[model samples]
Target: MIDSHAHIYLEHFEEDVEEVVERAIANGVEKILLPNIDSTSIEQMLRLEEQYPDVCYPMMGLHPCSVKEDFEKELQIVEDWFNKRSFLAVGEMGTDLYWDKTFWEQQKEAFHFQCELALKHDLPIVIHCRETIDETILLVEQYEGKGLKGVFHCFTGTVDQARQITNLGFFLGLGGVSTFKNGGMDKVIPHLERSKIMLETDSPYLTPAPHRGKRNEPSYISLVADKVAEFLNLSRKELDDLTTANTNKLFFPSK
Candidate 1:
């Protein structure tokens, strides 16, 4: 199975990063995709990618929360990295109003710029929408015919909103939140098309239930999958195979 988004590269796992990767592989996670938070995170992200090669892929983008007054400069840094190497996607990029709203406009601008970058590179984007799903959808709508395709990573939207995203050729990335008792995803997952679904851990955050209070790791993806499979009335293998196919269709189309 593929962990479509994770940040194991961060200092969150500094002491035992190798053990975390081993545990993930042991738990049957075949790939772990890493998303860059900003210029500051690029070094560690690339370092981890280099160490793991194809097993741990890297994506380039400025995270929404990281968007600030000098976003243009940060964007330039992101674009420069794109020119330097190929990435699995151009994200985790999107607007986040959950945090400070000081950089709201800059967040939108950064999202648009990164979306254009994804289009230019013919790559998918892994979005990060927090309390700004509607706005993010509207912005993505502006690129309807421009070959935009990707996943709304860590999606926690309404069923209709899920439909809106998938209708535009994007996937909904389900994570640990889906397993929460009151996470509300249980009500929506069963209603959405399984083909448009992808499983992710968003690890080092959103750890699945039974392990909710602990620091999240890719190994817990199996728990998330198990919950999704249960709700969808599917076997774990069936769910994994389906979501892995969806992931490949989005991130590894050439293969």
Candidate 2:
């Protein structure tokens, strides 16, 4: 199975990062994608990728919430990295209005700049939309016909919104939030075609039901697959096959 989105670079796993990754592999997770938060996290994420080259693939981008007054400088650093190395994608980038709106303009600028990078590099992206679905959709539409593609990670939108995103050739990334009793993803997941979906853990956050409120890790991605299987009325193996195939198409395009 593939964890299409995760933050194993965070300090939460600094003490047992190796064990955490081992647990994920033991749990059946094959590949894990690490999306960068900002320039600050680049080295740590790159180190994790190097340490576990087979399992951890690094993505470069400035997270919406991380956009600040120095966002331009941060983006310059990201651009420089992209020029020097090949990354999985330009991602974990989008608009986040859930937090302070002070940096809304900066977020938009950063997102557009990253989108341009994706176009130039001919790579996909991992969008991080939070309470700004409308704005994000608008930006995505602007990239239409420019070969822009990627997943909307931690998706929490209406069926109509999901359709809109998929229509634009993007995938919906489902994680542990779907397992929440009150998450409402139960309703949303059923409406989405399995082909347009990809599984993710977003760890160190959104841990599944039995482990909710605790620190999330890639090992719990199975819980998400199980929930998705139940939601779609399919077997676990079926869900895994379908989502894994979709993930491979999006993240490992060459393969």
Candidate 3:
């Protein structure tokens, strides 16, 4: 299976990222896509990619939470990287109003900027919409026919919102949240379009049930897959095949 979204490059795993990758591979997670937060993360993210070129795919973007005063400079750095190298996608960028709304306007600006970057680079986007899925959807709708595609990473929206996103030709990335007893995804997942869904772990965060309070890792994606399989009423293998194909089609189309 492919862990379509993860941040194993973060310091949480610095002591044993190698072992984390091993555990993920052993647990059948073949690929772990890493999304950049800002300029500060580029080096460690790329280093992980270089060390595990085949397994750790990196993406470029300035996260919404990082959309502070110097956002333009951060975006310029991200753009320069795109000009310098290849990335699987342009994201984990989107509106996140969970913590504070002081940078809401800046976050919107950055989100649209990166959405254009996705289309400009002909790449899928990985979104992180926290407490603002609808607003994010409205922003994304403007690019519906411009060949902009992506996944709503760590999706926890309602069924109606899921319909809105998938109808816009985007995919919903499910992770540890689905395994949460209070996550409320069980009602939403069953109603989602099968092909418009994919699996992710968002590692080092959103750790799943049976390990909710602990740090998440790519290896735990199988548990995510298992719970999601239950949600969609498919066997583990079926969910694996479906999500793997979906993830490849989106981020690794050449494969």
Q: Please write out the lDDT profile of model 2 over residues 1-255, one tens digit for every residue.
A: 999999999999999999999999999999999999998898899999999999999999999988989999999999999989999999789999998899998898898999999999989999999899878999999989889999999998999999999999999999988999999999989989678999999999989999999999999999999999998999999999999999999889778
Q: Against the true structure, candidate 1 has what lDDT?
A: 0.92
Question: What is the C-alpha lDDT profile of model 3 across 1-255, one tens digit per residue?
Answer: 999889999999999999999999999988899988999888999999999999999999999999999999999998998999889999879988889899999998998899888888999999999999989999989887889999999989999999999999999999998999988998889999999999998889999999988999999999999999998899999999999999999998987
- TM-score (all chains, Cα) for each model: 0.99, 0.99, 0.99
**Model 1: CA > 4 A from native:** none
Worst 10 residues of 1 by lDDT: 103-112
Predictions in order: lDDT: 0.92, 0.93, 0.92
* Model 3: colliding residue pairs: none
What is the lDDT ranking, best to worst? Answer: 2, 1, 3
- Candidate 3 steric clashes: 0
TM-score of 1: 0.99
